[model samples]
Target: MKNASPAQMLLGLRIHAAAFVATIIVLFAVNVMVGPPYWVGWVLLGWCIGLISHWWSVRYHTSHRTDPN
Candidate 1:
């Protein structure tokens, strides 16, 4: 993992977060269009929280990193 450049890591994070948000939007839209249960909202909420933490870690935790040369 540490072998990856910072750009590579950030790119991965951007893609992963975009995909997750898109998937959550689709699931919520499907739930609304079809009907009840409303489970997608809960799932979205949970995943959103997790994504926030992941983003935070990627952005700040790696900001002060040093190259392990």
Candidate 2:
């Protein structure tokens, strides 16, 4: 795939973060209903790592981007 522009990368990161938050909310509700082990924390931890990585990638790309001019 062609490389994404910095704006596209940032947009993707935002979308990913929003999805993560939404999913975590649903998972937390399910965990509360289940009333036990509370696996939402684990899911949150794993997804957080991915989200941080996505953020770092966007930061790196945007900082390193070179102008075509």
Candidate 3:
């Protein structure tokens, strides 16, 4: 955990974010993209991504870092 480098951290973010971004982009690109059928799922997916990203950010930051005075 602590040994992971900055590039690793970035790679983690990119991989985690990829699905969220991809779903949204594809949904938007499709003209049928709409309320319950499309946007709702994507929004919920985004929320999940947000939560996961937040958790990973906090986890990696705390894991890699030493407390400062």
Q: Pick by lDDT: which candidate is best?
A: 2
What's the lDDT for candidate 2?
Answer: 0.90
Better of 1 and 3 by lDDT: 1
Task: Write model 2 residue lDDT over 1-69, tens digit each, in one string.
Answer: 028988788889999999999999999999999999988999999999999998988898789877888
In model 3, pairs of residues that clash are none
Instruction: Give the Cα-based TM-score of candidate 3 against the true structure.
Output: 0.44
Off by over 4 Å in 1: none
Q: Is candidate 1 or 3 superior in TM-score?
A: 1
Candidate 1 lDDT over 32-55, as tens digits, reads 998887889788888889888877
Q: Candidate 1 at 3: error in angstroms?
A: 2.8
State the lDDT at 45 in candidate 1: 86
List, residue by residue over 1-69, the lDDT tens digit for candidate 3.
345665676666677678667876676667364444555565757668796876678567857676445
TM-score of each: 0.77, 0.93, 0.44
Please give the distance, in angstroms, between residue 13's alpha carbon in candidate 1 and its true position after superposition. 1.0
Please count the clashing residue pairs in each candidate, in the order shown: 0, 0, 0
Model 1 TM-score relative to the real fold: 0.77
Report the candidate with higher TM-score, 1 versus 2: 2
